[model samples]
Target: MVSFTASAQYGKQKKADTLFNKFSFVKAAEVYKELIENKYNEDYAVRRLADCYALLRDVKNAAKYYKKAVKQDNVPIEYYYNYAQALRGVEDYKGSREWMRRYKDSGGVTSTKNFGKDGNFITSIFNAKQQYFLSKVNFNSKLSDFGAYEHNGKVYFASTRDEGVSVKRLYGWNEQPFLDVYVTEKGSKDPVDHKAKLKGDVNSIYHDGPVAITKDGTTMYFTRNDFFKNVQEKDKKGINNIKIYRATLKDSVWTDVEDLPINNSEYTTQHPALSSDGKKLYFASDRPGGFGGSDIYAVDINEDGSLGTPENLGDVINTPGAEGMPFINNEGTLFFSSDGHVGLGMLDIFATVADKDNKIIDVINLGVPVNSSKDDFSFFMGEDGLTGYIASNRSGGMGDDDIYAYNRVPLLNVEGVVTDAINKKPIANAIITLLDGNNRQIAYMETDEEGYYEINIDRDVDYNITASQKKYEDDSESFTTKNIETKVTTITKNLELNPVQDVVILAELNTIYFDFDKHNIRPDAALELDKIVNLMLNEYPGMVIRIESHTDSRGDLTYNDKLSIDRANSTYEYLISKGIDPARITEHQGFGERRLTNGCDGSVNCEESNHQLNRRTEFIVIKMK
Candidate 1:
């Protein structure tokens, strides 16, 4: 909990202020720390110390001082937001939310307020599949090696790595050697010797490079400080604003270097990215009428190699905090770094999702491992989208900023066929349900006529695949994918469902009997007949049945035949009335006393139960599929 101050009344305070205003954050931080130690203007020095760490992407120290700065009276409202972001960098999300609440209460427009409406957002981000496996590239140095882009099988990047010389000039902001564009053999084994300066005049003595190249590899767009023709230009604050420049490749070397018309001495416009079709150029700028310290803008690349007016991407992509370092992939997805969005910390990379009309509709955070608490920017994806590179200033890197190669685990490609177990025949229109280990449904589809199904699923997850069809038993199989190694893997999983057991097996019904010498259905008999009607309507819609009625041996043959026929007709009418289609009842007949259950055909003594069975109607399943 340290504190400091700066006041115009002191000479040392004025010198620190001059350096701070010039963007010399590192040297300015040193002076601010000394002032705080000496107790000279403690209030202003404390807040400025936090600002220095924040700008340097040193989240831990930034959070430490910002905590103290926010407690002081008359603190600016934006300090609350900076403190909140610093808290997020340290993974203190609860503390971040509190400070963000205060910032919003004080009339600050922030993404935190928008994120608060969805309680599961943070959990969803963390719980999402970890699709990428990242490894540090070999050529990273102990300086700032970052901004990797690939073109024509060669990798190009911007780095402050020393070129085997002493007495090199350093940028005052970071006290590092000025950045220069460099090239290396793609996937080179000799990281030291294969790395060399780019084959072009684009690299300047001042900060240069981190470039974008068109698909044809004939043109390049790059960023550089406003220094040209052996002269450096400065704006009102004595700072050289950055600008974008275009260059052409010819005769195996880049030439025809020229500054783009979008450059303005009063503001910064840098970090160029060309669209896949080479018709649009996207870049970051802090020119007038921007929403924040910086915002992303786009300009049309005309047919004659000229440029059109710049268009701001609008408030959806820009916020009150800085947004910059845009990269557009071949699929037209815009990946950019932003500190304004609610994220894990200070500059997280977000990819835009656009509609079919090519208008950006949503932005998605590329959660952890790719993004860290420190600044992560400069994302480039290959055509397959699974292989890519990103730059991060987080710890365990070879430098202040290092490039990491990443491979996204491709979705598991699956196709299968479902069939009837007994006949080995395809089962059409069968429902296939896919569930996770938690039994939550992930996806579902109906099998085609060929009983074939195809779907893609996430890797390294447990799943249950189920197949179900009418008149068949449900079949399910458990599948688990673990540690699969491939760019894209295809698997086949076949399922066989057994047809339901015979319909007669469900015929264990109560004895459906008629009264002695009666041709009508009794109230008790109707209840039993309803069971047959229900089974036909619900379980087996295609079942065809026949009704048979018999009489006890106590009746005469002629009388029994007439009574049995009437009883059979009564059962048929009842089934039809219950919505069982008449077409499904193939026949109705009277068996009289011919089909006796026992020796109760007027020739032997039998119990009353035996007689009741002989006086019953029967539902025979003629056909079932």
Candidate 2:
């Protein structure tokens, strides 16, 4: 018979081995549960049980076990990190944050710099405004494929599935094969079940991927590389020397494949796209003078369809790592893929505004549903700016990369009215211009018959607006907007018409003209003052007015005073000829330019633009009653 002590030790050893062998974490957890419940090997059992729960995706239970294990035994810092992840998975964000804080305070190691900001992946994904899965793409295969373009209600992308004619073995993997390009029509239910190969002579034994099609669908641009051939040639950088090529659709087939001149030997250029108007081309390049590894660049398309010098887009859109595959809609909203920007996975798609002058504005991360803890990029939006496509390697897709369509809501709109300041009537045919804080014109729209105009503006752009008409003075106003999503904004401003006084007319300083060294009113100035005489006779039959003139400090004081008086009398004579009674008109006075509007004393050092401020004409309210 066996000894009781030997049998008890044997039983314990068998139990631990069984927990390690089952690999069925759920069952292993149950076995560990019994050990902990009976106070047998409590520390080991609790830690094992927590790891099992985490593998099972039971985050709440996982956290529970982890807390118990840490209390019983001092576990490694990684255990606490795992516990924080579990808390976050269970939507206990505050708890997760606190746990992370504690871990950091206890001197835990971190892979990245300071915690995520508002633009970071975890924050943006959780705070996304809209998100959904692209129903028909398969994401499990090992091919490196992405970059989708939407044109004329169809989606196109690069893939390396069984349908590819060319197969090249990949290194560092179990001899994985090459990839190719594929196209899918809109409203299709099954993507893989009904795949269509891109029609072209360009598909060779090499890899052909990452396509961008023009709005008219007549032109196509994509990347091509011969990794196998380059490897054989022993070219150190051959495997990554991808080049961009263009093809035209003629007779329903892509032909005449040609290399773009913009592709230089200095760097690899790929993922080319054409603007909506076909006037400019945008693409990704890792050439020298870029902000970092790779950045989106653009060039003007010549009349003969050749490219001009390419210009780097700068730090606004490009980061320190990689920025590629840019897609721009008709409204100038730019969509691109970046591994450099903060994201939830290997790569994520982002968006920003590509202004008319090619300035980048308002970079925004596309949050969850559209982006996950997987590779997602190559986005294309429709002309309507709301519906479009994306290429992702998420689960349940048709192949290594698949295309998806998304529906988006329209952004905010701004509307305002411009009117005559004096009459408060709608001003017709006024030129309304909208400028940003930098004084650059963002958009310009003309007022309709009712003097109302509307513009679709992004959420947070500061604006300065102005309206001008031929016969009236210009009116301007400035306002800054909040970052919140506002549905509509309305502003009303009245533009004042020029002077219309009676005997001695007064106008805004800018309207009246003065002689070269004298404040005496010129003949041309009298013609403008006549409008005031006409208004007095028609609106106030018995109204009288005094004309006032001012002179600069250029001449003797007495002579300057005399010149101002002569100018005012010249205005009075002109008003009387226009049927204004001399008896009803008051005499004139000269201020000799003593009181200037601007805070500058009459000095030679004052600039011409400022000196103009001192020369003016005015009429006071002497008899309003």
Best by TM-score: 1
lDDT of 2 by residue, 229-330 (tens): 223221254334567778789998877777778876447788777778877888898888887678999899888878899988777788765789887778
Estimate candidate 2's alpha-carbon lDDT, on a 0 to 1 scale: 0.64
lDDT of each: 0.84, 0.64
- The TM-scores of all predictions, comma-separated, are 0.73, 0.48
In candidate 1, position 98 carries an lDDT of 85
Model 2, residue 41: distance off in Å is 35
RMSD of each: 7.4, 15.7
Best by lDDT: 1
For candidate 2, the 10 contiguous residues with the lowest summed lDDT are: 226-235
| Candidate 1 ranges with C-alpha deviation above 4 Å | 1-9, 112-114, 117-122, 189-195, 355-358, 411-464, 468-625
